[model samples]
Target: MRLSRYFLPVTKETPADAQIVSHKLMLRAGLVRQTAAGIYAWLPLGLKVLTRIEQIVREEQDRAGAIELLMPTIQSADLWRQSGRYDAYGPEMLRILDRHQREMLYGPTNEEMITLLFKDGARSYRDLPRTLYHIQWKFRDEVRPRFGVMRGREFLMKDAYSFDLDEEGLKQSYEAMFVAYLRTFARMGLQAVPVRAPTGPIGGNLSHEFHILADTGESALFYDAAIDEVTREELLSADASTITRLTDLYAMEEEEHAKVETCPVPAERLRTRRGIEVGHIFAFGTKYSASMGLSVQTKEGGQVHPHMGSYGIGVSRLMGAIIEASHDENGIIWPESVAPFQVGLINMRADDAGCAEAADRLYERLREAGIETLYDDRDERGGAKFATMDVIGLPWQLIVGPKGLEKGVVELKNRATGEREELSVESALARLVG
Candidate 1:
């Protein structure tokens, strides 16, 4: 993508309303614009990052044996009523009246709806276990929504529902998702720790919220330092017992840990940090199924409610979380795994015909080699180009200038480390693609 042709409306001044680092950076970087209170219109650059994060979540979900599907943003209130939560859900539920005077809502979550759908189709124990997921927008009427997309009223989410014949089966399915969550966050350059939490509205006996530690995070968290050592590969291939051992690491969000007067992990091994909640999972047995009459035929020819679980990842919030967890004074230092563009090409002397031509050729080569590249072809000063590229934060910066062309080379800079090296055009291209 060429900067001159792009719609990025980057600003030199930070907005006073943005309180957090992510929110401020997002605005300054031109990633999004606030359309209403707690609601945002994701600009092109922001959408690309959000899409990348969603795809990673989807890939990890698929690897864990979850099938994908789509669910509507608006749902009939009758479905929530069946599960006995229509009134209990509170004002956060965006209640509305349909054309026929029927109660409808912009769904805050889809537990009741998913239960009703599965009940109508699958009837036997043969359909013993199934995990279905969808990536869609959900609305919650937060009285005070702030912090940009981190706490937006309308946001994209990846919610998965699991069904099993018994409690034991439900646990196994839940563990699969647990492992998948670890892999998913790691792939996006985050070390999100799973912390036990109270199942507030979802109403489950067992629940965990995955949190990424950041000084500006909303949730205060306590955990064993060892939890940080677990890798994506280890979690991805772990058995149920191996995944279960994660709970033994002694981690809890503020609400859960506040109940315990004494800490379990000892002073030395214990670690405390402010964390952003990015994902959550719950295994709520028979809550919705029993209420909605979503039962399957057992082997003994009796109808029984299946044990179930729900897993959720804040797809839109992750972009903010990533920025919070991975930024410097200049701007966001995006990880290559989820960066909007892998490389940024800056025409440092765009007014110079020679520099512009060389930069254009390099951009073509990078694109032809299938590298995700952004070309800054704008006729701007070198310092302005440099600052803009730094704010957007691509993994690498390819600098083209009249001086560099005379030296028979281009300058390459690493975004994260601020390291620079000059090399031949061929060497730079190889470094970029290879």
Candidate 2:
């Protein structure tokens, strides 16, 4: 993509309303714009990053044996009523009325809708074990929505529902999702720690929240130091035992940690840090199935309520979480897997025909090599181009200037490490492409 043709509206001044690092950086980087309080219109760059994160979540869900299907943003309030949660779910749910005076709502979560859908379709024990997922927008009426997308009222989410015939089957499905969540966050260059959490309104005896470590995170975490030893490589291939090993170690949120009279972990081994919640998993068993009259005939000719579990990953909030965990003083340091573009091709001397020509040819070569590159061919000063590239935080910046071209080399700068190396045009292409 060419910067001159792009719609990035970057600004040097930070928005006074943005209190958090992610929110401030997001605005300065031109990733999103606030249309209303807590509601944002994702600009092109923000959409690209969001799409990349969504795809990663989708792939990991698929690998865990979950099937994908999209659900609507608006749902009949009758569904929530059937599940006995209409009155229980508070003001967060945006209840509405249609022209016909029928009750409806913008769904905050899909437990009720998914339960009704599954109830209508599955009739026999043979359909007992199924995991269905969808990536869609969800709305919640937050009283004080702030911190950009981190606590946005409208956001994208990946929610999956799992139905099983028995408690044992439900456990298997829950564990599968738990491992998949670990792999998903790791792929995006995050180390997510799973800690036991209250079921809250979702209503489940078993629940876990996945949080990424960050200094500016909202949740304070107390965990064993060993949890940090689990590497990304191990998480990508982690299994059920991985859950056993990690959960066995002590970990808790600030509220939960305060309840304990005596700490189990050694003082030296206990680590305290802040974390941002990105995903949550719950095994609610018959909570919805029993309340909603969802049942299937057993092979032995008996009626039984299917056990259910819901898994959620905040698809949009992850952008803010990633930025909170990864950014530096300059701007966001995007992980390669979720970066909008892998490389920023800067024409340091756009007025120079040689520099522009070199940048254009290199951009074409990058595209041909399947490397996502953003070429800055705008008629701007070298310093401005460099600043723009740094603010957007592409993983790499390829500097094409007349002096470097004359030297038969282009400068390649690593965004994360701030390391720059001069390489021949061929060498730079090989390095980036590889």
Q: What's the TM-score of each model vs. the native?
A: 0.98, 0.99
Q: Per-residue lDDT for 162-281 in model 2, tens only?
A: 999999999999999999999999999999999999999999899999999999999999999999999889899899889999889899999999999999999999999999999999
Model 2 residue 86 CA deviation in Å = 0.5
**Poorly placed runs, candidate 2 (over 4 Å):** none
Q: Candidate 1: what lDDT?
A: 0.91
Off by over 4 Å in 1: 231-242
Model 1 scores a TM of 0.98
- The whole-model C-alpha lDDT of candidate 2 against the native structure comes to 0.95
Give candidate 2's TM-score.
0.99
Question: Model 1 over residues 1-434: C-alpha lDDT tens digits?
Answer: 99999999988898999999999999999999999999999999988999999999999999999999998999998888888899999999999998899999999999998998899889999997999999999999999999999999999999999999999999989999998898888888888888888898898799989999899999988899888778766765656665667888899877778789888888999888999999999999889999999999999999999999999999999999999999999999999989999999999887889988999999999989999888999988888988999998899999999988998999999999999999998998888877
Cα RMSD (angstroms) for every candidate in the order listed: 1.3, 0.7
Give every collision pair in model 2: none
**lDDT, candidate 2, residue 283?**
97
- How close to the true structure is residue 42 of candidate 2, measured as C-alpha lDDT? 96
